[model samples]
Target: MIILHNYFHTFPEFPPECEFKYAPENVSRFTEAMLSGNLRIIILSLFSFLGHYGVSIFVFVSGYGLSKCYDHSGESKWYIILRRAIQLWKWLVPMALLLILDRYSGYTHFTYAYLGNNKIWTDMLFMLTFTANGLADRFIIAGPWWYFGMAFLLYVIYALFLRKSSDKVLWGIIAGVWTLLIVLSSLGLDNWVFAFRYNSIGWLPVFCVGILLSRHPVYISWRWISLGVVLFVLSLFNRYLWVVSPILALFPVAAVLPLARKEPLQNVLLFMGKLSAALFVTHAFVRQQVLAHDQALPPEISGLLYLLLCIVVAWVYRLCLTCFYKKIHL
Candidate 1:
């Protein structure tokens, strides 16, 4: 077993010397062009196409990081899981409260008259109970809340497996779950209402791959990365392999990790990683409000604006939380 001490640092970081500092000489025409709002919108829109894979990547990273940090220091597995859940809850609770306020204050329309009983209340219960992903329908308000539920479930699975199972056993279990999900999807059970269509069952294998990587941090060769690229291109034409596309994308990313040790890249990546949860929870609401108010705005521009607004709002929310905590201490 390769035990890496301080393996999973809290946030992605690089050597201090590699940090981001503006250099006048390094400013290029492309960089200047990126400063323009319209150009930025176009560029961001292109990147946004990759957004569907974000949650899958997050689960993979979480599994890898948690596994790397796992210690056999005699602490109870339940205690570790609870601690992580509390940490996650600290961020989630604030967003949940804001959503509730929006729902009740007529700022957001969560209820549809067509649905006889209020589904919003059911959504709220699911959100609070960390089971929101069980609601497979996309019409519900706060649709992104499903990620939290799915992630929470994955965390519990990771904790349990890490505590009790051997690496081979864990791999076998992940393979079993993956095969079952594929079988169900093949039988058109993905459309079944009672089934956990949006659940982590489909994602567990990806997460397990991450855990395996943590145990054996193999250097991904250029050949593998090239193969991954080919697979990704092939996936575009073959819809059946779409589920594993994120895993293929991750191969190139893993290969590039070493090159990204520079400070500027690290800073940007760290900021995004830190605010990812907040942005995920808040972006849908921001998008809805923006589109509702400005129906004429192009979808690309609206998406760019939504992203910028989410970053600013999430930053302010974190600032407010810091102040509140400071006041409590006083």
Candidate 2:
């Protein structure tokens, strides 16, 4: 809400075709300052951070969960692959329905462009087959969904390479590649050399780090604390340059996460973790439909509405998932 209010006059973050316009650039700072005189500035920044911070956590959780899944399923690799493929359909169908609504409603929003397209089939194939990360290195760059695609690809690569290879050699190669991508991205050479696909590559190491940690949980504790400090410093100063931050982001997890996998915390984490996917996909829609409005509600009021809507949507999604899981006996 602070971010939106900051740009309410101009909507400068979006392309020109977008419905909103920016206020004049010369206005010193955006607040209800010379206008409504009702809202506080600190609140907006807090909400914006909330909107952004959950993503990295989601990625970390995903890597950890996938490693556990592979370990526990004990089924053939092909069977595990097929199971994920089926899960993709559960999401793809809802996404399809949303796309149809956006297209038919003639909404010319950025979200519309991101989600509605013929390439959805291609995207789904990439998603279901876990080829998105490598394929996205060559093609699409839509939104947060790219992370899912990259995760899919990372899993495939791990299965094909590290699963059968010697652990020492596998971790060495993964770490080497992950570090290289981070250095290149941070140096601003990612676009020219890797066409900015370094970000996707960066995440590969984290996902593997999770896998490796799952294989040997005890070594992670102290390492996580030490590396976490460095990653925290980097996060404060550096924006993720196309995938490079994956190394920094994964370091703490590689070092410390085994401690988190213990009983009660594990159960809580698992429950919330299951909602991460549905939350990621649905959060944007909830924000748009319930939070954003054709007319401005005061920023504080709007922020409250937005937060409330997200909580409701998340709850509803949890209920729906629970019912669906029960039906399928998952």
Candidate 3:
């Protein structure tokens, strides 16, 4: 969804006949572009909205995986956080250096925290520290690194507070937070805390859902799927719900993901899932380079090629990392 979402916006071409002026942010223009009778453009445009599910799923997965593995034995919370931090840093640091090198090689005088001396380092620091939530939605140039920061904080919250809480207490927190976010959003508040799509608190409800579900697995009956579909449909009609669509976006994905439970397809998914981290960290650079040199081709064709390049790059990255670890171990 992240790859496709970026591709949809990156291609940025309307059918030549349509003559519609559309910015990606303009809802009316997006509707007009979708109605332009071009199937590819319509599909890409729709995915730009639906693609939000990717982040929600990721957050849920993080929570679910941690809950499953976390030990109640005599282990320090800070030590667990350090392991997670190192895991994330191995994937992130190379990109930060590459971006720095790409942007500058000339000498500049250094200053306190390197704030004004070079603004680029600020981005690098944020990326490195997993605090890119400080950059938030303004981070088009920084790639999709905000999730790392928000995720790191989420882990800290889990280690310090959530791990010790009872399931009933967890449910209460989820309900209270969800209710508060909804009410704040309904009031059209502009605070970052109210932005359910971006902040950690906004995502807390779904993250807790993952923890709860991990503790007590449930069968997805037809009735549950029906309810999910109904709520998702109803969410689209209301202003506040639409703003927080990704919070419930998991419903549709959960409904669809079960279909790929068969053999070959399942293996293929697992392969790509291993490469997902590298793909997320490096795709912006691939997108930039692919578009820079390949403008002569059609948007749909170029977009597909961009995807191919991303997969290849991610595969190469994983292979190199695996070999590096192998040499170290040997």
Candidate 4:
């Protein structure tokens, strides 16, 4: 069995106490590119191959990092969950305000086209309740919000597992959930199960892998890295196999962790990581309102510009938050 204990130790934990802290050095460039929508640098079709699977990798890392922190901390589970929700709200509030502006200013049609017809208030409920995946079709303004909801729910579940169950029981429960998802997928219920973001139990295995690795980290070896690459390649040929792709992708990511320690690359990753949450929340709006309406520019240029705007906007939002918090302290 491949051990990942040492790998987890080298990287920073997730849901970091400070949003601007240095990112986990092991984070894959492919993962970062997907979040930042910075695809122009990727020359191969690998970008398309990894598409949504990139999000799976992110989810896995989040679970691993959060579990690591939770295990080390003595705080109550409810308190940790509440803190996570509040952290998310800090990012969400500004985006929510922007969405409201988009609605009154007639940019609503763009989102409606992508997300289907749904009331904004209903979508907000889904977002707030962490049920966006279950009601994804109704999330007209921010389909990506499903990720946040699903991840938060996972955090809650993981916390409960840690609090109430032994590690062995937790493993058994994860295995049962994973097997059930596979059986359901084989029975043609995959669509329904996947519709509810929390029910994408295919990813639960990935999350479990993360949790296990955190508790019992193994040394990073070339053999493991090779296996991960093989699995990632296999996942490309079959969609059903994509469920494990994130776990496999981590091998190559781990292999590169050392290089990420260097000066410029480290700085770049930190900068991107700091803005990742904001970029993720604001990129869709920028694409819909700015890139989509600009017919004069080529799609590639528009995409590049859209990503740039997301970075600028996210930076400004963080700056404002910092100033506000400072003022409050004063």
What is the Å distance of residue 44 in model 1 from its true position?
A: 7.4
Least accurate 10 contiguous residues by lDDT in model 4:
1-10
Model 3, 104-191: lDDT tens digits are 5554312111223356766677667776676554663444666788788889888888887889988897778767766665565545
lDDT-superior candidate, 3 or 4: 3
Alpha carbon lDDT at 233, candidate 3: 60
lDDT of 1 by residue, 1-330 (tens): 000101111012201100011112222322333455565433442243334555657778988887877734466778877877876687777766765555566533532221233565676677767777666655354555567777888888877765455789768866686566556546656454124436766677778888888887887678888888888655433434544565676865666787678889889878877777666666665655565665586554555565677678777877787687688872
RMSD of every prediction:
11.6, 7.8, 5.5, 10.0
TM-scores, all models, native as reference: 0.76, 0.64, 0.85, 0.77
What RMSD does model 4 have? 10.0
On TM-score, who's better, 2 or 4?
4
lDDT of 3: 0.68
Among these predictions, the greatest lDDT belongs to 3
Q: Kindly give the number of clashing pairs for every candidate.
A: 1, 13, 1, 4
lDDT of the candidates, in the order given: 0.58, 0.51, 0.68, 0.59
Model 3: how far is 330 from its true place, Å? 11
Off by over 4 Å in 2: 1-55, 71-74, 105-142, 192-200, 219-227, 238-271, 294-301, 321-330
